[model samples]
Target: MKIGDLSLPEILKKTTATQGLCFDVGAFSIRLRSTHKNFIHTFHKLYRDFPVITDDQLIDFHIDMVIANNYRRWIKPQIIARIDGQQPFQAFAATHAMPLFEWALNWSIARLGQHYLMLHAAVLERHGKALILPALPGSGKSTLSAALAQRGWRFLSDEFCLVQPIHGQIVPIPRPTPLKNESIAVIRNFDARVFIGPLFEKTRKGTLGHLRAPTASVDCLKQTAAPAWIVFPQYQNQAEVLLEPLSKSAAFLKLASNSFNYTLLGATSFNLVKTIITNCDCYNLSYSNLDDVIAQLDVLSDNAQ
Candidate 1:
């Protein structure tokens, strides 16, 4: 029920309650466990939150991992992750939990995670339709996603749109999209609904935390959203918010490049992407304003419907 009450492994596994990842983090308790004990715990002291119910679960998937490493040779471990703190009780999410979560996401999408497949994308939904935002790190995809969600769209994921190959639709992996630097302030200033997670003091990626996704998005985990639009987002200075028409060919190329598992599926992956781009309205959106982008997307959806 709460982070401190449940054991570490139980917390992560609780995500199986839906079909996605679960998070049980706070100021006091910081521990994580999956089906294995290969996780590290950096912190050594218990937190003060005790049992305030800072637990989140995502039970929307079946995972698969292709683990290869020197450690595997000895005991066959599938994943490696950062523990809470040096003392072993404080959970520094980026250093401890997020990495494991990524591997878990990779597993949920497919039963494999070798070097060949990948994507730089985030997922969210409305009604039952899912929107996949595939863009690079600096591309303002997260900003657009957060903005859309606050305005109305269900936030399925800020990053990682898990594509279930057999079903041929994106699997919802709802989690906070990490917002760095000014974007954090931008989101907080933009909307009070946005749940910005605990901010770390200093790290390689600068300060980081999870952007809380709406609970409704996670609740509708079983719904299937047909790929409606494949829009590559870019935030540019001095640029007006506009969605540019993009050819299916260019869209496919860019999307594949952004994918996390394009090469892994080979022809199957190619066909999946082709079907998506073909059926979806493809575009290149450039904007310096969130309001402008949000308004245009709403208008576009209304016209499409």
Candidate 2:
């Protein structure tokens, strides 16, 4: 049954208890347990559309977020992330539990999901054509991604561009887009309908919040689209939107450098990247205004016919 099928009271009862709760997210099933009241409340709201596991289903990642230790609980109070009973990262303040969960899950997928050539990019699709926006950190990738997803575009993923090599198709890995610092306000003011989670402050990424993916996106999780465009988006302050065509060689190099597992996949990665670029138009977009870039993308997608 869908998580929405259960009431808030029911979700809290299942998750806060010792047995934990399992939910199916696209191709992966996560069994998460957290007793922290605020964390549970946030989880229930952000993931309400996902289906909860009711039967005996195998869980891919068994995770937990809780206050660590008995003595330290009286002190500054820190939260720990346990994956299969092993804690790999250092603890953070208990207040930062939500962003911690989001980052930890991303770490799990980036490290263990070897089947797909994962890229550090935000992906979205329209009319069976996918756009891969790969960029370095602080390039305004997440901001642009959130704006697009809030608008008319289909949200695929904000952090990962999952590429299945054999078919040369982009897998849908839709999840809440993590908006950091200024991006938090940017999206909130940009889209009135956007359902943003609580502001998580003082994390390593500064003040953070999560924009839940559109309901339409979660319902179409089974659909996969081929890469039809590759745009490297960079947000600049007070600068006009600029969209420039990029060469295949340049695009391939940029994509390879930004991917999580490009070199690891060897020749298979090389062939797939080349094929994607060859079939798609590559562009370098620098924008300060969201509306201008959105309009430009509309024209670009329409001409892709």
Candidate 3:
């Protein structure tokens, strides 16, 4: 059954009691438990489409969100996230519990997902090919990715680019796209059909909001896309779409810098990254208009055939 199949009270009861909610989230199977009402509500809304399993299955990340039980509990309650019985982050206000848990889960994956060559980027696929968008903060990577996903490209992931080094294929890790600050509004206005999670105000990264992955994209989680384009995107106000080709060596260095486990993967990582750039077109894209950028990318991908 899907997570949305259960009512809110049913989810709360299951998590607070002995039976936990076990679900498949792309490459990982996560078992989550929480008693806080707000956290429960957000979890239900964010992952409504994910499949829930009742079997005694092995889970990669076992997480619990609990209210702090101290003097501060009376003053201002906070929620703590414990993964595998270890707390990795500082306690956050109870109001921020949902985003905190999501943040914690991403952290757990980056630290524990050692099998793949993980890059901190946004990725999407179309026509059996993947578009890897690796950029620094404020580059509008997430915003552009959300736009592309809404415009028909299959959403892979907005956070991590999971690449199978041996095969040079991009694995789908379709999760909610965390839209921050103004970008949240940008996406909301861009796509009326997109489902966005509750607004998280004053987060460390500023006000945060999450866009649920498209149902079709999540349903095809097992499908892998071949690396076809490595494009670094930047958003400049009032700037027209500017696409410039990058040399293979330059693309390699930028990709390596954005990778989470590139150095850890050693020669395997280096070779895989090289093969991707060699087989795909690499470019730097800057634009202000979303439609223009999307059109440009469509033409670029078509030319690669």
Candidate 4:
């Protein structure tokens, strides 16, 4: 059953401040135990489309967010995120529970989910082919990916591009895309139908909010896509939209640098990266207009098909 199938009261009972809640996100199952009511409430809404698994199902990650035990719990409270009973990060203010949860889950996947070659990129699918957007921070990758999903492209992931090592297939791990600062406002203005959660002010990445993943993408979590195009996106103010063709050799090095476990996987990663670059078209995209960029991408997808 889906998380939305349960009422708020029922969710509280199952995810009691003590017992925790378990849900599936693409290939991984997570058991998150949090006492922060706001975080739980927001999670329930943002992840309403995801399946809720029974306690008997195998859980890949066990997470806990508990208020500090000292006097701080009452005076300017703080929260700690623990995975497998070990704290992997410094404590964050209790008010930032949602961001903390999102960050912790990302950490868990990047550090422990070594079965796949993980690239720090956003991925989406259309016509059975995947589009990989890999870029550094402030590159508008998340913004572009979220916009594409709204325009009917299936969202695979916003934070990670998980690729099956054996066959170079892109796996879907759709989660809430965190839109930081101005991007949140930009997305809200871009689409009237989009659902964004409440804003969390003064976080490390500046004031940020999460854009909910489309239900259609979450529903098709089992479907995987082969890489079709690799586009490195950058957003510049008032810049003309430009999509330049990139050489395969340059694409390989750039993609390899964007990966989380490229060095760890050694030759396996090398061969897989080569295979992906050789089969897919690559481009460098710079734009200030979201609509124009998306339209150009749509034309490319249509032409390919």
- Identify the candidate with maximal TM-score: 4
The residue ranges of model 2 lying beyond 4 angstroms of the native Cα positions read: 17-19
Clashing pairs in 2: none
Q: What is the C-alpha lDDT profile of model 1 across 1-305, one tens digit per residue?
A: 32345555554464334332333221012223333322212110121112223334322333322222444435533443322211212223333344444444444334433322335677666655666789888888888898887888876666666565665676555545667777899889898766665565464567765576565564554555667887889999889988888999999899889877677679878987888888888889899988888889887777777
Poorest 10 consecutive residues by lDDT, candidate 2: 48-57
**Clash totals, every prediction:** 33, 0, 0, 0
- For TM-score, candidate 2 versus 3, the one ahead is 3
lDDT tens string, model 3, 113-195? 99999999999988888999999999999999999998889999998998887687888888899999999889989888888
Q: If scored against the real structure, what TM-score would every candidate get?
A: 0.68, 0.96, 0.97, 0.98
lDDT digits (tens) for residues 85-176 of candidate 4 = 99989889988888998999999998888999999999998888899999999999999999999998999999899999877898899999
Ranking by TM-score: 4, 3, 2, 1
* Candidate 4 Cα outliers beyond 4 Å, as residue runs: 17-19
- On the 0 to 100 scale, the lDDT of residue 274 in model 4 is 94
Q: Tens digit of lDDT per residue, candidate 2, span 108-173?
A: 898788788888899999877998999998999999988888778898898889999879888887
**Model 3 regions lying over 4 Å from their true place:** none
Maximum-lDDT candidate: 4
The models' CA-based lDDT, in order, is 0.59, 0.86, 0.90, 0.91
Q: Worst 10-residue stretch by lDDT in candidate 4?
A: 11-20
